[model samples]
Target: MTDLIAELDPTQWYRDGRGPRYKQLHRHIRGLVSSGDLAAEDQLPSEREIADRAQISRVTVRKAIAELVADGLIEQRHGAGSFVRASSNRFEQSLSSLVSFTENLQARGITSASRVLLKGLFRPTPTEAMVLGLSPHHQVARINRLRSGDGVPMALEYSSLPEDVLPRPDKIDLSLYELLRARGTAPTRAIQRVIAVNATAPVADLLDLAEGAAVLQIERTAYLASGRPIEFTSGIYRSDIYDFVSELRLD
Candidate 1:
């Protein structure tokens, strides 16, 4: 008698697989993990028990579990059983509206913090020229940071602005917009572009995502009241965590 039970879903891959039982089982479990039906830290059924239930050899179950572990989807402790890996959750702000990260998190009842990644004077590269409408000879201030809310990393932001705009990039605090306003450089409006992308190696490392995970990329060119570009920057956000919310009014 088969001791193991499966939620029989006809649409699941294993139902018509052309492989051995072990291979079929492996694919089935992975599908569940990817779909989030089996969540992180949720214990997988014991190998011995599952083998007995599925009427398969224990070696088959072990082979399947080994592959999942290698992919970082499951982990096995010395004594404890295997468990699914949990990915991070996310929060998102809009590219259409003007707001600070601190303010946005506060509105959501979550605390926000910043860890500065890069702060220095940078001469504009060719890419910056196209984005900011600046000459290659122009110098800008660069700031890279990991912005988090309620202690979870949300987005990786890299911004560049004319050096004359900030005066001292190192002295700036959490709210860049607030500082700009204090210095009489209010960014009245901005033009932004949005794209969906897969996180690169460095981004994945900082955002704690599995390599090549989906993310949203937003690039903005903020303008001063005089219609002069004040800042040009981009942000990468986790796809699972953030869903940009926008409201449209009919004319």
Candidate 2:
């Protein structure tokens, strides 16, 4: 704490013409975390200690700490002071490609795994039936999974496939696309809609995030080469760790 206090001297961090004082403090502390000067899980000095060393008011210090917490750079524990959070791995997924979550992680050299929360053949819901072009009387294979990369929970996925496309839900262990391809039912294209949403209680629990955390909701309907809709899937992903990118081109 002493070393940290000395390093945060006002002369070095607090400066004129650098926007707000609180923001300056916030950037300095963020730099420390990024540079590994303040490693993950390292305890931060008390607000009073930092304020005293930086020659700033406690209010200023508190505001800076609040910004850090909101940025996911630090976390405050009740009665335990602030701590640098462990850096999370950020993954960029290309919107131009049609790929599975498992494939995306594997391409990045991350070990992908899933915890199957639910899987069975069931009557298709209205949305599922409409999206997959299934009749109300037809059944669908529903698979729900908590997806992880290198053991970090990253997404909660729910997928419904026409029974003809996925006859055996129990046979699915890893990639659903792999099974579909083996059965000659792989989707050649998809229409996806992405939206920002706050995590609900169940989604937060599955993704190991606090309730109301920002998340990306993706709803997709995938089609076979013959233009038949085969899969309808919805997923909630951690916004802090995922970036969806697209390359735009002019005609």
Candidate 3:
């Protein structure tokens, strides 16, 4: 494994001025995978070795490895270290690109259904005010739902929107994107922040998990084509059942 990794070009990261050193390192690893040099199920060089070889800090190596893991390109074992993961997970992502949840799931051949927990008007809290970019005392449409696929709970979606621009709660269906489209407020783009978290009581109950089970907490803000804020959502997803993936094109 070390010998295979040693063949990689060290100048790849410097040539690619896309982001920080960590992202560039990630792109370099991705390039190795694509070039057929890093075979399937191959174990990657240890962080210490990679750090020495790349002349970067071990912390940088760890950060690069984490991004690859998040993108589902690698998996770490207890005592064995990180290795290439199955390719199934890489194709399972539609993190952005403005597609409906139902559509994305159906395209992946997964069963997706929604249970509406709440759909009504509410005043935004300070946190929500910051997320939704709302006034201190502005009304917003609050939609809380449990999104499941293949009969397994995936996430608890907590969303908010400016009430003046949204329709009444009774008109909402399972697909919020569809409803948004019908109301002429479809989301054209979105920004997402994903983080690992431990489930609290309410989140555990919603996902049918034992307390403190790991979860992915994703915070998102969707926007319209005109750059108008459409919705702000905070989602807690079951880590065992869901993954977020994306391809970072490497030079």
Q: Which candidate is the best by lDDT?
A: 2
Q: Per-residue lDDT of 163-216 in model 2, one digit per residue for the tens?
A: 988989989999999889889899999988999998776776577554455789
lDDT digits (tens) for residues 113-180 of candidate 3: 98999989888898778766789778888888999877766789888888876748657778888888
TM-score of each: 0.66, 0.69, 0.61
The sequence of per-residue lDDT tens digits that candidate 1 reaches over residues 1-251 is 11124632223334332455555566556545644667767887788777766666789789978867765677888798887776533455675689978788888898888999999888888877766677878788899999887676679999998888876899877988889888899698998788989777578657655445577898888998888888988999766567786667899
Of models 2 and 3, which has the larger lDDT? 2
Where's the lowest-lDDT run of ten residues in candidate 1?
1-10
Q: Report the Cα lDDT for candidate 1.
A: 0.74
The alpha-carbon deviation from the true structure for residue 170 of candidate 2, after best TM-score superposition, in angstroms, is 0.7
Model 3 segments beyond 4 Å from truth? 1-91
Model 2 error, position 102 (Å): 1.1
lDDT of each: 0.74, 0.84, 0.75
Model 2's lDDT to the true fold? 0.84
